[model samples]
Target: MKIGLYFGSFNPIHIGHLVIANHLVEHSDLDQIWFVVTPHNPFKKKSSLLDNYQRLEMVYRATKDYPKLQPSDIEFNLPQPNYTINTLVYLQEKHPDYKFSLIMGEDNLKSFHKWKNYELILENHHIYVYPRLSKGHVETQFDNHKKIHHIDAPIMELSSTFIRSAIKAGKNIQPMLPQHVWEYLDEMNFYK
Candidate 1:
């Protein structure tokens, strides 16, 4: 099976994430999309992030109804400060028959070259890029790269940071999250 690894912190899974994953599976050739919930993101601060298992629970709730979209906590057991390359390598070893690819936004593609062993990753796996409302140019090297594919998915401006802040301020961000995910966060009183 061809799996698209959509890695993220998923502090609390939201509708925007589901939309992207659903769109990709339905529109693209990918067979499934695994939401690889990272324990810690190298570019993000860990202070505002929720517990790894808690965040994973939210993801599980959000994607329960979608068979094509599944939640993954594969990075939790890996060493801290882990990179995409390490995850890719580990996944390949465990499931050599499955073709794994990356699912990222254009914003991430802009700085992808700086990622650890990016060249190696490009050489081994395909990267599916979605649109995002962000500034800066992608490196010319990746513009027409055969291994990189720009998918015309929805440009999701919604972010976990914005949702977290809204909840803390007593705002009704219910519609922004999946029904089950919203209920879970509300019951746990997270970010508030």
Candidate 2:
């Protein structure tokens, strides 16, 4: 089975995240997309993040109806400050039958070199790069690499930060989040 690993903190799952996952599943060769909820992103601050289990639950609520989109809590049991390379290695060892690829935004590709063992990731797995809101193009050294592919997925400017801010201000964020996720957020009074 060919699986695409879409890694993120998903502090709260939003429609933008869903759109990208759906787009990739429908348009790309990937059979399924696993939303790997990172316990702690090495590049992001942990203080602002919700509990790993809480974030994972939100992901489950948001993607419950989507057959191709699945939430993974694999990072929760792994070491803190989750590194993509380590997770990929572990996943390969555990699920050797599955062929895994990475799904990332062009913006992340710009900083790809800074990731731990990035070269190893490129050597072992393919990367599907979706466009994002950015002023300039990503200048990657692997532009012509066979393992890297540029996909024409829609670019959504909506972010978890914007959603959190809206919730704090008591603004209507219904359009930005999945229905179940919004209901869950409202019931839990998250980010308030």
Candidate 2's error at 69, in angstroms?
A: 0.4
Candidate 2 global CA lDDT score: 0.91
Which residue runs does candidate 1 get wrong by more than 4 Å?
41-45, 135-139
Give a tens-digit lDDT track for model 1, residues 38-121: 886556767778988999999999999999999999998998788899999999999999999999998888889899999999
TM-score between candidate 2 and the true structure: 0.94
Could you tell me every candidate's TM-score relative to the true structure? 0.94, 0.94
The alpha-carbon deviation from the true structure for residue 82 of candidate 2, after best TM-score superposition, in angstroms, is 2.7
TM-score of 1: 0.94
lDDT of every model, 2 decimals? 0.91, 0.91
Q: Which stretches of candidate 2 lie over 4 Å from their true place?
A: 41-47
Q: Best candidate per lDDT, number?
A: 1
lDDT of 2 by residue, 60-122 (tens): 999899999999998889877668999999999999999999999998888899999999999
